[model samples]
Target: MTNPVPKTAMTMREIRHQLGHPVPPPGVPDAEVLPVRFVVSSVPEGHNARHAYTINVHYRGEGMYSVGHGLAYADGDGAWSYEPSRSGEDDEHDADGLTWIAAHRFELTTALRLARRLAPTLTVRGRSVADVLADGSPTAEGTQR
Candidate 1:
């Protein structure tokens, strides 16, 4: 078997750039995925944009974030998006373009609010997304207990 190309984790810069491109995003060369909070939403799943599209909110380190076009576009198998890495290091997947906000514009709540506005059906890991930023994973920042 041929050796792999050796993947690298995506930086926020790369993700944002990919999203804005006019053509199409790349599919080959798997990307490393880092662990972070995520939120999901969708109007409906279909064959077209208006009827079928999903949005995802991904937390970047230090209160930064990005909104992806469709369940992150390849977060599943066979495509480009990524699911969070099991280890804090990285995940086996892809990181395509994203519309990311600057670190200054989003704290936890701010990011959540934006995602909610975009998709009223917002959810976090199947639980109520309200106050999800209050507490959870080791990276969560806010009041304790």
Candidate 2:
């Protein structure tokens, strides 16, 4: 019996199938889908406190010359950023176009789930005043936090 495929491999395969693209053979150009995570942090100097949020999602498709798209979930919000930007190359434009559409659909389900969890945290705080300089540089006296 054949060994079970690794979860990472399975995920890649699922993404390819979802995009309706066949797996490429060795030495041939193939498309790839990857799950990616991005974290955003707030850092303050002279203070020990820090806050970070990691966002995880899939980035699929192929290279610049091949038709592919890279997609990711934005940090904390569950919104997806779909990259449909086409690199003007003859070999991969068609494939990339198709992949772009596929990636957008792939993120919808995940985004909805994540959004629900994040909705409660989105609130605005009152504004505070700060100083500025005419040359777009902060004055030395205003540097103190």
Candidate 3:
């Protein structure tokens, strides 16, 4: 039977449910998008006289991620701060400090792609992020510097 409601009329949650995506528990407001919680820092290692910066990837309920507003770097004065994206609302934060919304609440693959573009040397337990993703275990704790 065809669905009576148009696809556009259905909420993302409803659409996801119909498509067999995981259904969030009752009363979870705006559970459609997942945001990353932990912060991922990008350190420039094995580079020639390179500066360092940080990028926080908040991991939402699923394998979804919300990349930070902009790269966090030390200014000329050497104070660390977020550059803040030129695009508004690129970095929305919730009460728990997670980015509320991003240009894309990227899944694992997409998130890794963005990470690789920015932090190619990002590694967990000395393994490349790609390798980690290949093994179906991207949840390894970010090694503390």
Candidate 4:
């Protein structure tokens, strides 16, 4: 017997519509879409492990444009996670406070592809601002910075 193929989850357009965000213009470069699925695992520390989540963002540009995935996590007990895509490094809390080690960005296409891959594992409930934010929430918050 042959195994059945899985159906397509959602297209970039469909996802954007579902999420209530405007889709990027056709052929537009460096356009970004949000609320991609990501997973979080903790890094062992003194007693607790640090949790982090991955996010996919799209960027359209000229010669070099692609989608990319980013890691984000909380800092200490802050409300927001320090986004790796923005900082470009692993943010850490030290005597000097929050410091980012890396600074990286992603392409729009790459991010869309990653989001498509991760959508299956992502759980969705209602359509609300908080829900959207929660859906987009990173597994962990950034460090003290």
lDDT of 2 by residue, 1-145 (tens): 9998876546565688789988665566665454343222222323222122223333343311111112333333334455556766754876876665554433535544553454333222331111111123322344434
- What TM-score, over all chains together, does every model reach? 0.29, 0.21, 0.28, 0.22
lDDT scores in order: 0.44, 0.39, 0.47, 0.37
What stretches of model 4 exceed 4 Å from their correct place? 1-81, 84-104, 124-145
Candidate 3: tens digits of C-alpha lDDT, residues 76-112: 2223345343444444433223332333467766665
Candidate 1's clash total is: 4
Which of candidates 2 and 3 is the stronger one according to TM-score? 3
Model 4: per-residue Cα lDDT over 1-145, one tens digit each: 9999989889778788789998767776546565444332222222112221233343323422222223342222222234433333534434123233222223444444444454333322333323434444333353321
Span of 10 residues, lowest total lDDT, candidate 1:
94-103
lDDT of 3: 0.47
**Which is the better candidate, 3 or 4, if ranked by lDDT?**
3
Best by lDDT: 3
Candidate 4, residue 113: the lDDT equals 46
**lDDT (10s digit) by residue, model 1, range 1-145:** 9999989988655876778734334664445566465644543232122222345556667655555545442221212343343443332322211221222235556555665565544444563333332333132232232
Q: Which candidate is the best by TM-score?
A: 1
Ranking of models by TM-score? 1, 3, 4, 2
lDDT: worst 10-residue window of model 3: 44-53
Clashes in candidate 4: how many?
29
Query: Candidate 1: which pairs clash?
Result: 18-97, 19-97, 33-91, 74-81
Model 1 spans with C-alpha error above 4 angstroms: 1-35, 42-52, 71-105, 120-145
